[model samples]
Target: MAKMQRNTVLVVLSFFAIYFIWGSTYLWNKIAVTELPAFMLAGIRFVIAGSLIFIISKILGFSLKITKQQFKNTILAGFLFLTFGNGVVVWALKFVDSGFAALEVSAQPLVVLLMMRVFQGKKIQPMSIVGVILGITGIFLLVGQKEIIAQDGAILGMVLIFVCMLSWSYGSLFVGNADLPKNFFVNTGYQMLTSGISLLIISTLFGEQWISPIDWSIPVITSMLLLIIFGSIVTFTAFNYLLRIVSPEKVATSSYVNPIIAMILGWYFLNEDITAQSAIASVVLLTGVYFINTKKSLTIFSRFSGKRIPKDPVG
Candidate 1:
């Protein structure tokens, strides 16, 4: 009974962590990217976080071993989800508001649905078809705003963010069946490490100037630390834990909540403008996500496939 009660407390706290911490990451990334090159900033953040996870796993007596195929799979997942999916979004933050980026990325479930149809030939359920329609309407409302599209590079940023969405959606499908490390923590660590290394290499190839920690302003430093500790490590750990303890549908609620938190934080802290059109789009888009999530037929991955479908990781 005591163990059950303790588990309940942990579940509540974990939900809070994923909901709040993951949502705030957009603001943190925006703050950090203002002064640092995007690739270098992301590379350093993930590398340090991944290394810390490795150290902690060792201290907790978790083995870090994995087969070569798992290693290769981790690399592929990392590049798709983090190196390109997340890294490119960070770069786009320079051109778009943090809240805007969050709102745009919230359309991920829609993209995943379309991808499944195209690649897996999965039949789109009737309810999900409605979601796809609403999602498209919301995206059009959000991106078609003249005030937003009129800004220099705004269109480019939106385009790149869409591409990132594709990468992430595809990664979700791939990881569903891929043979990864059995330990979720270790699997995440490996993905981070591999992706971090790839990002640094890309940073070098792109000639992004690296800034020393000593030269970073207090805000940038604080944002980076927050991103590493809370956004990446703590929230990811909670996310995996919640997946084990609850229905993935419940765990997936973060999708509905994160953009709301992000938009509020971005508005309060960064003074980002949120127009009426954006507010309506948020309603429409999130409603679409709600429909998709609630209908079992529209679940991210079909369970009938006899493959393990992991919940989508926090952005």
Candidate 2:
């Protein structure tokens, strides 16, 4: 009974780590990019975080051995997820609000579902169709907001974030079938390092200028450290653990809750407004996510009707 209780506590904590910490990363990325270049910021973050994790994994006696196929897959996953997925997000933050970015990312599960169906001939549940409809409607509402539409480059920024979501979804789906290292920590560390190096190369190709003697101000340093320690290392560790222990549906709940937490934080700390439209959109989007995850197949069109789809592996 005691062991079961401990496991329950760990699961709950893991959920909190991914939900809140991952969501909060948007804010930190926004702050970090204010003084640093986009890809450079991401490169620094992943390199440092990956180095620390690599050291810790060695200390913990986890073997770092990886096969050639594993290395190739890891590089591909890293480019899709961290280099393009997260790196584009960081670049887009120059124009968009952190809360809005979080809300946009809340649509990732739907994106992943569609990608699987398109690329792998996977079937979607009827409820998933309903979910996709609602999710798209919510996105339209969010994107059509007058405040957002009025801003220069806001729509473009949004388009880039959606691309980020697509890249991440593709990486998530692809990595599941690829041969990765058995140790989650080691696997994640390799992905981060690969992504970091790739981003650095991209940054150079673009001729991104470095802010010599980085600001090192309190908020800048604090956000960078938080992202490295909590965002990359701790939250990712928790996320990997949850994938091993729980149903994917339960773990995917983070996609719903994370945006809410991010919105709250952005409002409280950065004073980013959460308008009525945004609030409504968030509710609609989360409702869609809930339907998708729960496998509630609402029959809409005869053409769209199908058996329930299996849960996807965690991205």
| Best model per lDDT | 1
Candidate lDDT values, in order: 0.85, 0.78
How many pairs collide in each candidate, listed in order?
0, 2
lDDT of 1 by residue, 256-307 (tens): 8888899999999999999999999999998887777664743546452122
**lDDT tens digits by residue: candidate 2, 232-270:** 889888876776676556666787877888888889988
Model 2 lDDT, residue 214, Cα = 60
Model 1: which ten-residue window has the lowest total lDDT?
A: 304-313
Candidate no. 1 TM-score: 0.95
Model 2 TM-score (2 dp): 0.90
Deviation in Å, model 2, residue 73 alpha carbon: 0.8
**How big is the positional error of residue 292 in model 2, measured in Å on the Cα after superposition?**
1.4
